[model samples]
Target chain A: MTSMKTPVTLDLSAAKVVTDWTHTANLLCCRVDPTGKYVVAGAIDYTVQRWEIATGKKTVLVGHQNWVRTLGFSPDGKTLYSGAYDGRLLAWEIGLETPKPVKDIPAHQGWLRGLAVSSDGQRVATCGNDKLVKVWSAADGKLIRELPGHAHVPYCLHFVPGSHELVVGDTFGNIHHWKADDAKPSRSFEVKEIFYHIGDLAPFGGIINLAFSPDGRTLTASGLHKASNALAGSRRPVAVSFDWKTGEKRPKHESMKKEIDGTMWRAVIHPTGTLIGVFEKQVGFWNAGVPDVAHLAATPSDIYDCDLHPNQLDLYTAHYDGHLRAMRIGRG
Target chain B: MQEQHYRPCGDIEHLLGRRQFMGDLLAGAGLLAGSSLLASPVGAAEVAKRGKSVVVVYLNGGISQFESWDPKSSLETGGPFKALPTTVPGIHISELLPHTAKQMHRMALVRSLNTKQDDHGLANNLVRSGRMTQSATEYPELGAVVAKGLERADFPLPGHIATMPAGVGGRGNNAAYLGPRYASVTVGAEKGGVANAKLPDGMTVTADQRRHDWRRFANSRFRDKVDSVEIDAYTQTYEQALRLIERRELFDITREPTKVQDAYGKSELGKQFLLARRLVEQEVPFVEIQPGGWDFHHNNFEFHLHYVSDFDKPFALFLEELAQRGHLDRTLVVVMTEFGRTPRINTGYGRDHYSRAWSIALAGCGIKHGAVIGKTDAKGIDVTDRQVDHRHLFHTYLQAIGINSSSEFDIAGRKFPIADPAVGPIKELLA
Candidate 1:
């Protein structure tokens, strides 16, 4: 029997490596339970797969007619909400032996690009290329309110923690802040100098993910940075953080090292207040007053979703090359 | 018994036989000589009053058949989009074209075209010129042929106008043997119309009119002193330029009402298509609107979503406009491309060039609407029935505009058939 070679030492000071569960197809979105016992990933193959973290057993959940681009889990981890390009939102009761469809709403007009569940798990919010953000009842799939402030197609959105505020980000770099209870938006912010494509005239890029600090003081929107030519998947990853209260953007932008080729798909802030972003095949962490730390060749394909473990010592990522990877980070 | 009797005007049989004899004589002599002798003043007036026009919206780069039309949802190659029911019964297209689906009754689709050339440049030339490059002769393009065949001396505008410049199809032989006069007058391919058409700053309408009068006087005096074919051609060019200057308002899209403009979405492609309709209304025989960027080698679905959605609304509005204005019977609209993308997708989730089976759509004047003329296999990889090529489509276009597909034009003393000699028009596609 042949023995495997020793692993190479990585210069990751704040964290260490963990198991990489990598065998899914082009995973677009993923959600981990609060206890980190199981993980569910929505994939380009139109199927949602739930992985048992301890045993690595896989159960495939199927219903979406197109690519499952967005996923949200209830606070209790009993219900899984998924949105797809077919403009459908399906709520799956995950506790059952075979995941059952609790409610299916023909949500948006076109591709549903964004999905969010309230912290209370009572309300679900969805946004799509139809340029409308809809809030629905998680229990009955009833409409709550329609927020239509997007001047362009929206791709990512989130609910401000500890409040009823919802911030929706679109392809045009316009961010709308809604009160969730109000019909009109409270305010809007524009990253006027930032764009996603290679040049001003090239095709537009969508905001892939947004993150908020634990204190809700900083809000960061991350995706592909502007390029000089075609958006041919060559642009680097970029993120801009804004102060929520003052609505003033941080003057300095954080981008991954030049070694990374493709754009970043998702970003999340760690419990230690470090901004960690997932790129095409790697992840990077940016801490204030320090050189940005990046890990290259972490996965084989583009990482579309990055979720922080409840313990804050582990990082889980879903990839476009069909991978669900986990990296253990600790204060060694 | 009555046919046997001789009369001053001649009996029906005698008149018919005489007309056939004259046609045969003219055919043997030459086309130009015969045209003058055969055309009568009354017949010319009728022909002018009901003249046909064609507007070709060339979706440059091979668009994916599975995403646009002929979507085979049952196959693995079908991608994510589902086929939606069009206005035509037993026919369905990609769901992305919801607006176009409603107006499918006014359009006929040809789904089985096997052009055999996958290279963009070669296929573009084949589709536009209707024949392979010839070593002995340069053949005219579809637009050039239409322009030369349907040209009216009284019409001030050029016979054919291209909203954008040509693509992939090299610029070498656009006019070919037909010469520059019959070539397309390219307008807003980029910015959406003739830029220099507007008068210079501080130039008033009165000054423009006076300058035009002086130029015409000078040209007339020069023509009297020196006359040649070259001189005549130059004078004709000068006259056409002056006419365009006088009627430049036709190129201004702002003249359209805000409601009408909004219907077309105000995109550059939409505005160019709107300008094409206006040109058709002005009696231009042919207009080609070039909306490129279908060469999606990386993110085919994303790009198609953008391009196809951009095309759907404005195109539907254009078809409706033609029908409402009672020009449907005399104006032909076509949506086509160089070829189609492959059915097998690559790792980038994109499809490359596939020429074995594809689709093109035709509508309006003399076209059988709500018709699906051909079919592709389950995987859209092969032509299962009613296979066609560029030559057959070109012939059908010629026949749709009431042009004689078999007519031979003398180019440099060499005869050139309007359509290819080997292939004939699709008789079933014609009304």
Candidate 2:
């Protein structure tokens, strides 16, 4: 057998390219609203764009003063909350003329980096440069409590579906489990080996992006080598899976080779939760639990964000070069 | 009996000959060990009664000096929001906080906190920890120190507690370097059912009671096996947890009458403040309540109105209730943020982050109410006088509660000063 230089490779033929945003639309996130009618995307242009799934036409919700880092649609799809870098959390009523400021609790003293709304949409949790994970009431925008355990900045947060627990990832490559009630974390695990350390100067590197499979059985995280030489910009990407309940990390799947070169920005579980789309300089789709090669997609430039459509199996990818592309997947 | 003396080099003979001299040097270097050893009989007696408590309301995002406590009514930087007069003569606050203005007599407004860190994490750590930004060892939060210094040995509850807004963000709210035991007990209003302040459902009353008893028994057995200060600390933690369980009602704001709840506003922030009051009244030495989401890069006016409105009513009622209960004088309430929003409105019609000059307020306890400590330029850009930094801010809080900022704690066999060595409390604000 030929020597395998890479961990995984993807087949690009199955992906059918759809509409694309030429410029000013570096999409950061896409979510099919709870109603499954409109897909909303947080973009680098500091705007939240809504795409009609049927026609693929886009409408923009403009107001945020900085890059929109994360967005979540209310359970009814009528309300949307966008967390931005300018340290503001804004709320928008679907058809309203303008997005209204509901409860603007300066969530973090630094950039408002990441946000995750609970499955029920009643609680909204946010993590950022503050290095603290805060949980709030989505209905009235009141801060209910906070989790102050992480020593470094928390990059991502997700509420475990159907459980009163939250999984939080910090910049230090540690994943902590915080019970729904207690502000203190109950369990913690570190991925020391899988994570990269630039040197004594810059250590702490693990997964920056995390996504839980719909069934909550699996967790997919994208890893990157720590940037040792910032000027050299030599960052490589890798994907790892874990047993959500036991926190047992699986080996670096062999199927994902080409996708492991650049830094992975995001990993999104498809609607079915069986397929995950990983974004780096390009897009790669992999089947859950199979460890098979990821099917790579041809893209205009480096991919910064990707998300699955609310209902269909379509994928939306955003690029650093300011382009948003829509793609549909088909069976071989 | 000759007094026992110890030197940094661990030489007993040298320590005895120069005991007084070495003692002063060690104390100055923040290497003092054990409170009993430092105090002469007279000094020890004075230390016992002089320690006071503080309640810090850390507003995570920078609160604007112009809009909050130091309104520049005549300047172009003042923007559209107007200032309203308070109960104190010649004192005014933003129209947004009319309620707080009414209770101005119990508060002292510091209009010139000139902290260096404009960044949230650094500024918060600097102000809360009261150390220079690059200081090595993580300093204990003021609350943790109070917990260590003043918490009653028999008390079964955590000495320091923190209740913040769910999505409020920032750094320095943590109990750094003090270790896990002294970390603030975080209580949320939404998750973990803020109203149901108890063990989870699976843990029945009988089961919880058994767990508590068994934990105590196990700790006792372990203590007997290894007699050390660590065992005492662990036992104290266990007892605090037990006390928390017994006085769970203190954390339950829902148990209050509907009228009382309404007075504090039914909002999460209002309820959280109510919970904080309950905690301090129940004798938690320190409580930090963080209310964030104030960074208004665009539409700063509308954002502050919507957010601060929630704070206006409940905060006033909280102060009123505290004063009514005669706890205001013993409880120090501080309202501060990391920095402030920029005075200039940007393209997005928003104000970017500004750290040059900002406003912070303190009320109750040892603070002289109805006092305004400093002034900002007409445009609200710089501190005109009485400039304060993290050290001064922290020292003022410590002095309010009667803690000496010069107090030292030993870590890794080295003496670490609690507050910044350079700055002291703002004498003007102190009672």
Candidate 3:
């Protein structure tokens, strides 16, 4: 995996929206192919859309019957794996002129919320409303093992960098570490700082995503805390990081005290250890080594997911306003 | 034959005195004249239709057909929920209502409803009153009409009761021309369904009874001085309140066994539904339950995930309890909303109002069991067949209880049709 030697810097005042790409249907998730030729996003219309980086030529991939909320690309960027609310997982050959689904399987009984392709692109980890974390063979969509012990609905999952183990996040903000081949978790703990639960039900503000630093030393779990009106979508975004080896929480990135009216739907850790979180209103870039946000970039609309471009200096964000914005980081 | 059932003209007092159900209640209201109360002519033919009632489970804002009763999970606009098969074969509904699905044999579904109004206020008025709002005229709500049609003169309690959470409700302006007698009394599970129907800790029942007797004497004197509709109506209501106080046990579901209470669950809506079942048992005629907070214009699925659980089990349990207790034979239960949510989900992961096509579930009474009426196309944007509206539903509701919707009511010599004449009852739904 290519790592960014230097992530976006706020001291240089370099992050800004460089271009705007529009789709009439709102987009939910985003991913950039390693080839840097296309930026693909999942739209509310139940279609994954790919837009050419240069000419803005758009292609619609229609196979899923529901919102495609999670997307991942193979290391070669030729294969795209998508999980949708319809509980179906699809494998697509994006290298073709007309991208088509090559493999489709019923991955879960209900909403398939979280998915991650392994570093070697041979396996995929997924979790859904069924409270099951499953690892599947990426080649032919075969379930390898079902990781149990999630008492609540699992929201996000990720393969540890340079390792086969997986860390899963759930509605109660609990993170469970599972060995790739084992059904039982090696360790489990709660990120209580970013989660809110009234009781056994109406649980909101849990860990929506889990991201590991390039070196795999620190793990950042992102969601909302102190939800004032969870039903009205009122909450504040927060990302809490933990020391991987010792399981000690690093007391950084927890001081986002500004009460934003949305959730930190997703977060990604850069090679430089800067955690980028897309929230309801804007994208917040936090210095992972400190307790405060380094910079905040306002998007054209509230954002759901963000991915760094293959060029590393640029970012693509899927937004709630039916548009995907490209944020260019540079000397401009 | 139907017109003979409702004689709202003179001799109402004679008919009122004849009802054995109103014996103690009417005497407490000072509505019974001396000899007439003893030798009243009761109608034996009216027994079957007299106690028939209606219960409306109002879902407050718009309920998504895609998430509740009429899901088309494979379509582009179908959203995410799977359409699980109900107890009745060939009929499927949203998986979000699994508990309701188990009891589908007792219910009928109307899937193609085009009420035509999308705004909450407009659709609420249209859905409840069965008439579009206009400055020129207004109609009584379904609850008020039901209460007026089926309220037992013998069991005299609040005819229409709205069990609701704060803000999401329907007590005021509901009666319209039906008058205050039929207006809904706002009740809650937190407090008693009939507020303060108990004697003070210090006061004895004898003392309260004496006080009631003195008040009745005074009200009788006032009636003797001025025989007016206002006075008669006031006496009737005051007596009804007294009767409610006497039978206050009806409001306290705590009197029910712990297992019974637990079956209703701990959720607030569950308790309200328990209260509704209590009212249903006592023959209160019309009960409207408003769980509210369904205006999910944001986080629709997540919110539904949290919200539907609060009511689904209780809903299924209610039907189960009614059937077990034999009240289902005389009670018409309707589960509806102001309108349906949009098939096209918005950017906020929400759905706005869409009245073009939606659904409501009906059960018991005169409804045909396991019937599924009307159909929406592949996409639920519009009704594809047998489309019905609120007017037709209103006509059906009355017809379900043996009331002829085509009959005219002599409202103070100003004739009024019971239901809109433009449309008739949904015969396919009627037993």
Poorest lDDT segment (10 consecutive residues) of candidate 1 chain A = A193-202
| Residue B262, model 3, lDDT | 94
Task: Give the runs in model 2 whose Cα sits over 4 Å from its true position.
Answer: A1-332, B1-52, B165-173, B176-178, B189-204, B212-235, B410-414
Model 3, span B223-288: residue lDDT tens? 777867666665666676666667767776778799988988877788788988989887888998
**lDDT tens digits, residue span A196-310, model 1:** 5421123555565677888888888876655543323445567778899999888534453554555567778765667788776677877742334444335555677878767
Ignoring the other chain, what TM-score does chain B have in each prediction?
0.83, 0.81, 0.85
**Residue A111 alpha-carbon offset, candidate 2, angstroms:** 30
RMSD of 1: 11.7
Candidate with maximal lDDT? 3
DockQ of 3: 0.28
Across B1-431, the per-residue lDDT of candidate 2 in tens digits comes to: 33333213323223333433222111221221122121112123225533245677776666666667776554236754567899999988987788998999888888887776778788777777777778666677677666655645455666677786452211122445454355566555443313224445354666545544554565666676786654564454445545564666666677778888778876767877887777767767777776755665543653564567777888888889888988887788888677877776443335677878888888898778788887888888888988887788888887777766676655545565667767788887889
Task: Give the winner by TM-score: 1 or 2.
Answer: 1
